[model samples]
Target: MKPGPVIRIDFRGGIVSPGDLYNILVAAGRLGLRRASFGLRQQMFLEVDDSIRNALCVELDALGIDYVNNLEGFPNIVSSFPAEEIFITRSWLSEGVYKDIFDAFDFRPRLKVNISDANQSFTPMLTGNINWVAAPGSPHYWHCFIRFPKTNIIYEAPVCAYTNDLASITACLEDQLMKGEMNGDALFGHPAMAHYLWKKAEAHLELPPFNLPYYEGLNRYGNKNWLGIYTREEWLSIDFLKSICRLCLETRIGQFCITPWKSIMIKSIEDADRPRWNALLDQFRINMRHAANELNFQVEDQNPDALALKIFLLKKLNRDDIRTFGICFGIKTRPRSEVFCNILIRRRAMIRLGRWSFWYRYDICCSEEFNPNKRTAWVFSRNNPRWLLPEQLRRAIIAYYDGKSIAASQQVEQSNRQPDKTAVQQIHQCGECLSVYDDPETSFGDLPAQYQCAVCDAPKDAFVPREWEKQSA
Candidate 1:
């Protein structure tokens, strides 16, 4: 049978720990997963030294892993804006966002021109093959371009263009598609969309030029970021040497697809008694899907330029992790407005996969050092104390590890329990000599009392409270 669809994983945001890589490898072995892909983030800043690169080669060599030089999968190009503007968009925009609707249309077969100022009207550049998708919000401008083999550019000057509707947009696109000749060099928003359009041509679909399969496999199991996010989720466990194994025995589907941060396992693993590890895997999957869906939820083709702009804004805010742009260039340098058609056709290139793939090796070797905001120094700095950053997190960890609330002081605890003081009093007297105490009721040899220092085996009396300990009882 065919190897199924390609499986890709993002290493930067997902794989953060060594154990993460081990678990994924184990899972791959159990499932017979032979190929997968990994995405790298932060290409410009992270540099992989020879030693670290050698270490990576050794690890991949030992495990028999293959990789690709596909970057973070962001197509960083803008159709309507100047080349300089695209870079500005990147620097100002976060990872995954679009600048405007023109960007979305730029990826299409046509370029639209607006004539708000009569003095700055574009040289008419349209052919029977060219078309336009009128700007949805500001109809005063037309937003499409088409051309003939070698003729004066056909111009579709808008006289109060704002009233154009969907019918007009559809007509323009259809007119361009019908014409046997149009600019082939312009970039489109989604390659898939372009492919779909090309396929619309009965003959074009039948006589396609591409020969290779559309998808490629990527092996990304056993990545570090995956471990940081999920320590020992059983559904992710590897049981055998050639396949990925899962703890989801009850899953109706026998197989699953997992990325560094996301796991697409069989539906049956959702049972309540499936063990902590299995449940943990399910929870992780739940969170991953929720996050991806939320980010892409608002993305739509309508008013693409505005949508792209919103996306750009989100990326700048660090709200979205994957951004795409369509590249396009112009024939003439000046009369920026006049160059839309020629520019769209010549300067357009889609950057689906970018520097992320090339830099992944560096990312894996030292993610902590590369991610500035995540570096230990930044997190623990006086200005940004880790403990105080989020109050709920402090409480949650404490709740998980018994009632030892991180925010509560020992002295405060003693005073709060004055009403039911007997239990406190018993522990206080023994606190000094107790190397450790478990509930005094613990069976004699089940495990020694944890009341004393496990390392030095010293009596509790020898323990001096650190500043964080507050006043002694």
Candidate 2:
């Protein structure tokens, strides 16, 4: 967004998949885009063997592309160093580690270093020989650290998850803002995160929302069916970049980057059933708005989808009337089901349900492959496989505690109200599955937390205890 003919392409490994790279080259040739850079990740380096790298090098050479390579992977060497020696050793070994990683990739293009972790003091050593992509901790104020002018340093949003700490993130943003350098930053990570960062950058720059779809339409069909959304044209515009960089500096999570080809691929996949995708999104947005109104909580701009999901989940799981609903509509993944279950458990909405609490049940089911019956409630305990994010697990637990508090309050409030004797008698006469309540003297609290379904007793955790208040008292 800043200006004319600066280096492009921070070739993150995911972006450089063989097919994707080929497409990028073909597109670049058509556009007459000369000179670009490659930023490869450690995982990507491992994934790409010699043949692919050599092939890529040949393609770039043929296209007259001069590249800057920053391939990085290390064993976290400083963790084992003595306190006094940590900084110095890190300063020295980090460059070599960068070199080692870069050397591993078979491409013979020019190499440089882009240090992701700013806390480490390795930027100075790697700066002179190669390009330095700045995050929060980079120090290259006086001179062009990578032998270029202000344009050499590539700015990116503070790393996600870790960037949640506002003080540090703000400090980083202030530094980049003060520099007033024209070069842009790579908002690397997930699509959601990338979009969040883009908005954040905009806020920092005091600009308006860049309607991305106006310039480069998304689909190959060129917006024929109102399906394609223009994204890159928006990204390439200076006004848009400035605004996004400013906004991304504030918060964490939901930031990501995807290759152009990958974006195209996703469009192709969605285009197969565009109406269905659009409808689902529209329904989700409506549900979210309704839930937010009910809860009196504003959804975060960065995570509306997640917030919407939570609202729908609360509505569905906490309902006492409905018995069964599919977690993942068309997907067959067990983890998705487990994640839904975890959300319910953490919200603390599953109280005294028939066998296995919902969370436990989901954990067990997701951990293994079992045929799910549409009409039957399947309950499980202690056998679920955990996910990669510990934070997710923690959230589930917190939600459970919160839900419990709400439920306890409701119970206490109900107890404070007195009902007419005749009305109570009429309520007690209700009989549809009364045989299941064989022990009338047992308080509802005494009922097992786990239970089978009303009709089939297929082990389930969907229903709560009913009646028996006197016994509980």
Judging by TM-score against the true structure, name the best candidate. 1
Assess each prediction's global lDDT (C-alpha) against the native. Answer: 0.25, 0.28
Report the lDDT tens digits of candidate 2 across residue range 194-229: 332222221111111111121112233433222211
For model 2, the stretches where C-alpha displacement exceeds 4 angstroms are 1-47, 61-473
Q: Estimate candidate 2's alpha-carbon lDDT, on a 0 to 1 scale.
A: 0.28
Candidate 1 C-alpha error for residue 114, in Å: 36
Q: Each prediction's TM-score against the native?
A: 0.21, 0.20
Error of 2 at 77 (Å): 27
Candidate 2: worst 10 consecutive residues by lDDT? Answer: 75-84
- Identify the runs in model 1 with alpha carbons over 4 angstroms from their true place: 1-50, 68-254, 258-278, 282-293, 297-473
